[model samples]
Target: MTIEVYAMLKDYFEKQFIIKEQITDINSLKEYLSEQKPEATGILRSCRFAVDDEFVSDTYQLKENDSISIIPPSSGG
Candidate 1:
């Protein structure tokens, strides 16, 4: 499935990629991402997952073509 991953910061990752393996839920997606990019694991764990603009949990079921985003905590000085 091809999931769109938008990062708040460009330095986090390559912006997006397609997953050849089946990703049934957010938890599985996270795990897959961690394996692909170990350096981002720490930051990724703290980020939030949103599917199609709606905030979702680890149990949220994902489907093909679902637009996903990795929203990190934000703060203003």
Candidate 2:
């Protein structure tokens, strides 16, 4: 699976990365990210996920080569 991260998330993993797995569900991906970057766990857990431009839930399944993006919440003046 290939994932693209934005904003602060890029600091945890590369701005874009590839995972060697046939299927990577949203929840598993979140767990892996939090494990790898403990510092970003809270933020990652609250963030929204999109695969191929459509938002999906934690149970959503992802196939290899799928393009995923993580969008964390934001606050601005």
Query: What Cα-based lDDT does every candidate model obtain?
Result: 0.77, 0.88
4-72 per-residue lDDT for model 2 (tens digits):
899988777799988785556999989888877999999998999999999999999888778899999
RMSD, model 2, all Cα superposed? 1.4
**Residue-wise lDDT of candidate 1 within 32-75, one digit each (tens)?**
88887787788778888888788999999989778888777777
Q: Global CA lDDT of candidate 2, please?
A: 0.88
Top model number, lDDT? 2
Model 2 misplacement above 4 A:
none
Instruction: Look at candidate 2 and give me any clashing residue pairs.
Output: none
Quote the positional error of residue 2 for candidate 2 in Å.
Answer: 0.8
Compute each candidate's TM-score over C-alphas: 0.81, 0.88
User: Number of clashes in model 1?
Assistant: 0
Compared with the true structure, model 2 gives a TM-score of 0.88
Candidate 1 segments exceeding 4 Å error: 1-9
